[model samples]
Target: MTGTAKGMIGFDWAYCRALAVGVQDGIADEDVERWLPEARKVHERILKERESGLLAFWDIIEDEKVEERVLEIAEHFKGRLVDNIVVLGIGGSALGAQALFDALVSPFYNLTTRPRFFVLDNIDPLTFSQFLDMVDLGRTVFVVISKSGTTAETLSQFLIVKERVVSLLGREALKKHFVVVTDPDKGVLRSWVRESGVLSCDIPPGLGGRFSVLSAVGLVPAALLGLDIRELREGARAMAALCETASVIENPAYCNGLYHVIADLDKGKNIHVYWAYSDSLYSFADWLRQLIAESLGKKVGEKLYGPTPVKARGVTDQHSQLQLYREGPNNKIITFIGVKSWPADVDIPPAEEESLADAGYLGGKKMGELFHAEQRATAWALAEAGRPNITLWFPQVTPYTIGQAFFLYELQTVFMGYLYGVNPFDQPGVELSKKMTYGLMGRKGFEEFVRYL
Candidate 1:
């Protein structure tokens, strides 16, 4: 938190020491503060360049049209009897939606105020086939998302869904059962929207898939959940404003980014674990896995960079991975996420009988209390064992707070990209693997890439 802590979320690095991480392992405020000037310089340049309209994600927080379009599209099918929302996307296209769905939606949404939601991000044959067999096409709407509109796995899923819809409900069902979120100007999906009259929304041009969840890619799903999508963006806009502040040390985004880089480069910690105590929050870590790994895991002038991102849930991972974190390779900086309050809680209830006396200590306590108690204990254990860790506290889980968390980490990752001297916007390594897949799948122009094999 350094000097810029926001109420939407509280950053506690107390065990990261008084100002967050202490001089443990030779790291302290002095170590991280020294990078502030460089951070300030980077921010000034990026902010100036951002005005040139180069960073689409940064601008989305203020773009009302994107939200308008998403809500408009959501109502088209949402007004009907739609029962399921199956997102056909992969990587960036899928992770953001998954994060939002898991974080903001109820664990039992299908049993309550909404429809069942699924993200078909992978093309594993068995999983894909089983998913298709599981949902009713008549009551389902397939949301196809691909910024380029030519993503292989997504397009394949779309084709199969479209064919099934066409066979069951005829070609007329296409407009009602399918909606596409893709490039506005040009792409296969764009052209399809025009020619086929399928409902569609534009993902702002130049908005990389990873950073696009704030755009149509995420809002489309948020809209489906009947969430206050505007409030979500408002949270993001607020965080963006904080990240844009003049002083780098006063901004959580910059300070957090600088320290992680400090840990990786100066302390030789190459793994960063995002361990969340809430099950609903596990998806954000999954999303971060892609965001940090894909954005910073780059080769710059022959040196491979970036801390490997690992996702863990407290209590579950407390039993599973905490041992390694405490005694394994002392090469990780774990970031623990905890909720300040549970939206709803259940009492532990006194043990049924004396036979269950071993659990009597928790009789009157709320489950959330126990949940966070374990989280607190885990952080203390790690820090005590000399494993550096940080915590992000959510006052409560809501669309607005969820938005703030997304922007916080996304901006932090981008700032870390600058400190590492790489273009966070591009992923040439992922692109190479994509081309190889296209070649092996028999795409026309990718024939040459297959030769590399």
Candidate 2:
């Protein structure tokens, strides 16, 4: 699992190839070919947009300034005895760092040599209070992230934490313990940093919060944990290059989007399930949920479209949801994500009893072995039941492989947006909710909307 493979992530669409065909439900190899030329054109156009700076997120890996700043900050905290890092931001801000920490580091990371990471992305007072008790305030570092610096949830959390730091160590101590990641020239956070002399970093202009992983938002926390940030960017940069090919068959990202859209539009398969077989990857499913849900669920003029994205864990979801997935409806397209090798494994000892003979087949088997068996069995069963499923194979789960995954999915999302004829970068529905919250909270401009309440 530790060995570094150049292209560790893979995509398999065989079960999709086995699907029932027609104008409504089947995806022949020809359908993939038919869609390739147009998808290629769209891919090329997106690259053009990147070149002109219309899409800032895609250019993150190639930005030398971002990498330099991230590395510099990482170096500052590298050998220091910083015990805990509390990251304050919701959605994109928190999920990316959480996914990286979960996938690349050990589950028992805090107890090990790695600095403990606490991502505060919610407003649960009890949970927030509990975290304060879990770590010593003086030994902890706070990374407050908000691209706009106006997100109410993030600012509220920052206020509570800032007050505690100020009271415990005085206002001057904030300079040593806190760092703000926000817009460089604007936002309340930037102003605060300027006035208080706190250290800070800028989230690249035009980069959305969800796509800020390769930017300072995600890299800061990852670098602090001793991960190879450069290698992670290299993996993403390589994947981005590979996905630029004109042939859809050669581009995994393009192919992935094509199948999902075909299944959703042609067939009645509207539920898109992202089933990851690794416990470490469960949070990654959450990250993808936001990415897919926010990016694709939109309207192109009068047409309303977008497949529902569902997150399910392997082996665990087998017991809970497999029955419905198998017998209930032919409405779901399952994407199985699995690892070829795990960092460590445990062998199941044999049952030393006469009555346990029925379960003897599992004895002396590695946990990962059984996990893969279940995955294959599930795919086989679904195929037999006339269900369509695809597999995303990961040779190993390292920072490099994860970076490849992030870029691959991001590219796939953009391709899907083109297929659906919608802008993938904006979240108008989410903004409406934000406006409502601002009105309810008595924010200045949103006061007019409060009348409805």
Clashing residue pairs in candidate 2, if any?
Answer: 21-26, 24-266
Model 1 regions lying over 4 Å from their true place: 1-7, 17-26, 111-114
TM-score of model 2 vs. true structure: 0.95
Clashes (backbone N, CA, C under 3 Å), per candidate, total 5, 2
Q: What are the per-residue Cα lDDT tens digits for candidate 1 across 364-434?
A: 99988889888888888878777788888888888888898889888888889988888888888878898
Residue range 1-453, candidate 2, lDDT tens digits: 111345568887777764532333457776666677778788788878977987777788888888798788777766766888889999998899999988887788777764688899999999998988877888888999999987899999899889998999998889778888999888999899889987788997688888888889988888777788888988888788777776676778888889898888766788999999998888888899888888989977889878889999999999999999989888989999889888789999997798999889989888889999999999878877778888888888888889999998988998889888888888887877788899998788998777766
Over 4 Å off, model 2: 1-6, 19-24
lDDT of each: 0.84, 0.84
Clashes of 2: 2
